[model samples]
Target chain A: MKNTLWKALGILILVYVFAMTMLVPLGPGLLEFQDVNQVIESTREGRAVPEFQVIGFGTHWDQLPDSLQVFVQSKGQLAALEVIRVDDATHATVGLTLPYSLPAKSWNVLTNHPVDGTLLLENGLFLSDRFIDAKATWPAPSFIEHSSQLGLHFPYQPRIVETIRNLMLHVPLWFTMFLLMGIGFVASIKQLSNPRNQRDDDRAVASVQVGIWFGVLGLLTGSLWARFTWGAWWVDDPQLNGALVTVLVYSGYMVLRQAVDDERLRARLAAAYNLFAFVILVILLMVLPRFSESLHPGKGGNPGFNSYDLDSALRAVFYPAVIGWMLLGTWMYLVTLRMKRVNRQIELLP
Target chain B: MQGLAFLLGLESTAIAFAALLSVLSAISSRAGAGFGLTAVLGLPLIIPIVLISTRYGTDILNGILWIDTAHHLLFLGALTGGIGTLGFILFPYLWRD
Candidate 1:
């Protein structure tokens, strides 16, 4: 058991990661403002804006109501929201009494609490375009010191508030797949050069079989993440298509193995196919996805992991998760290789 | 115009498709692999070429010039080259046994 120290380390790291992934609370973020029914008539003339129920995640508005400063800021214009009442830490009511002279309707919400620091939401409120061109000089910016909250909390993103936790779960699977397939590719190349030693073929097949398992997991987890974030189980994105195609190509390798009758011939043929398939896999997954327009994060024009999306707190856990998954995949591949070798031995006994 | 684009696509498709078919048939006939196994192996490889060429054809029909379709054209060419080269190197090994 002590000989398999890395396997035990992988188990330990995975257990630690599972705990960290769920335990780390996300930072304060603005939820939607309750919609108001009172529509303003063309002008702010004699009309009063309704009190908006402000909702936030992990914000302490109730306890720090006195120090709570809410403002709708855009360009050079600014209008601080009047906190009429504090319902709870996550709920509050703020008067939307705009500065009658303020001309901007497209603005952002900024709230500063002594404890939680400043939470900002982009494109928070839009009064209407009617007042956008209104001839009025707005209030100057009230430059206040925005302090950072002291604690380990994941950075809150707009649409991916809580589901950002999926980064730890979904991305590591693919990275592990890439690593395993790469190992398989090297083994296949070695087998092709030295067909006399058939052990390399077993090693290649074991690595790929385990690799394919991880790839499938990556796809399913990616689909679920897409459903939560992109509002669909599947989309015709280039990265997605590339990944699906890569998996299918490898699956074809399995069928290729079944088609061949002789054991020696099977090993040689399978090695050749694996060599071709791995090159195609790299091109499809890595090269092609980068060139094409894709809906996946960090792709063409899609709002994905912005500058602050992959935060330091996420990296602390995310990097460990990736290494852990890779170790586990390697462990699985070794076990598969051992099992295949044992089966071959049993067949030879007869 | 679409017909011309499609005809060009059909020709290119035939070349790449033929390459795939030849590779699969050579290996299968050598081993007496069934039709299902041959197809199961071939489609995954051929589909990407078909996918790329279909896009190229669509672009041409949408009034994109032959010169403007350089990226797709070069890509299709590159895929064909990669396929041909892989088969050239690998087939010799299969021919031995």
Candidate 2:
């Protein structure tokens, strides 16, 4: 018992490590920043619109350096460029490109030259197109003329926020399900080979019950994800449809075992059905979703993580979560098996 | 099930009837009491995975378009198979008559 306890503790530590590595790093990978909503209220009515300060590490600023270089090449502004140092990074005031005559307020302190009457920020960071119209008179005709350059990337990166937490959901259910199904598979194979062993039959049935539980879980989790990712509670995508059918099929396997009264016949028939269903599960889950367009990973044409994506950080916790859950599940199965044996013994008492 | 549907194409209309028939066969075999007991005992096992699979599916998707529908389904199937199987194996006596 001491040795067993130590081994169990070791296994648990390994699992915790695994989950931490997989689930935690996902948060940083999908990191995104939000636009700082500065309150630019009109302090003094109309002498000048209050100048806004870009705050909260604005996301679209990365595009500015290239735009600045283009302006330099085009002779857009002869004004001397000055770099403002903020936290060891050089930030351009956009006012540097103006011809000294335009006040910082005129172009909203644009680091690039004013064109028409408006100023262009990095990657069309400026929300309005009228700014582009205003900056047309600036020397850089090439920069202000394009429409595509003006579109800013969307402000919020919800994918980063939502996807990192998914490790807890999608991966664990698969782990639990696989653990239960393996038992079912083992029990069925054992009973088929040894028909007289009621123990094997009991074990097989218990495995099926647990499997059905995981299957339902997989569906519920998938549905919740669908709402966020696909914006629907359910969709007819091949993957979604396939999973639904697979769960439904397995549920049938469970119900069949319960309805049959003859112990011998029930075991045999249920075992056969379990085998068939598992095979179909493999094909449905493994084979068919690959052939067409699917809104899921590991399918052709959909973007997914490559080998590099499963970095050391993710692998660390992920492997453990898998093992921990698998062990916990197995422990539960064994306890049930023991109880069943005891009950059977009690029933047999004369 | 596109697997069945893909194999049969539009012919799945025929298979659906058979699938329904199988469901009835299963229902008649299992006790309703057994089913309810399984549900009651299984809630804790089921709820967490339900929550986890969704969260992980999104994380795995992570703006990479390389993965398609089949992958998602397989991930889910593997998850269900793994966790549910573990539960069954771990708690066999729970189903004892």
Q: Against the true structure, whose lDDT is highest?
A: 1
- The true-versus-predicted C-alpha distance at residue B72 of model 1, in Å, is 4.6
A30-55: candidate 2 lDDT, tens digit per residue: 12111234323332232222122322
**Leading candidate by DockQ:** 1
Models 1 onward score TM values of 0.88, 0.54
Clashing residue pairs for model 1: none
Q: Per-residue lDDT tens digits of candidate 1, residues A1-350?
A: 77589899998999988998999998888987765565333232355666677789888777757878778877766777777678889987777767545567677888878877888878878776344555666555475856655589888877788888888888999999999899989988888788886899999899989999999999999999889879999998768887888899899888888888887788888887888788778767776665567778876556555555777888888889999998899899989999999998998995
State the displacement of the C-alpha of residue A28, model 2, in Å, after optimal TM-score superposition: 5.3
Q: Which runs in model 1 stand beyond 4 Å of their true positions? A: A39-47, A76-78, A99-105, A133-139, A148-150, A301-307, B1-14, B64-78
Q: Give Cα distance to truth, residue A337, candidate 1, Å.
A: 1.0
> What does DockQ give for each predicted structure?
0.56, 0.06
DockQ class, candidate 2: incorrect
User: Interface-residue RMSD per candidate?
Assistant: 1.4, 11.5
lDDT scores for all predictions? 0.79, 0.49
The sequence of per-residue lDDT tens digits that candidate 1 reaches over residues B53-94 is 888888887887766664566667666767677778888777
Candidate 1's docking class is medium
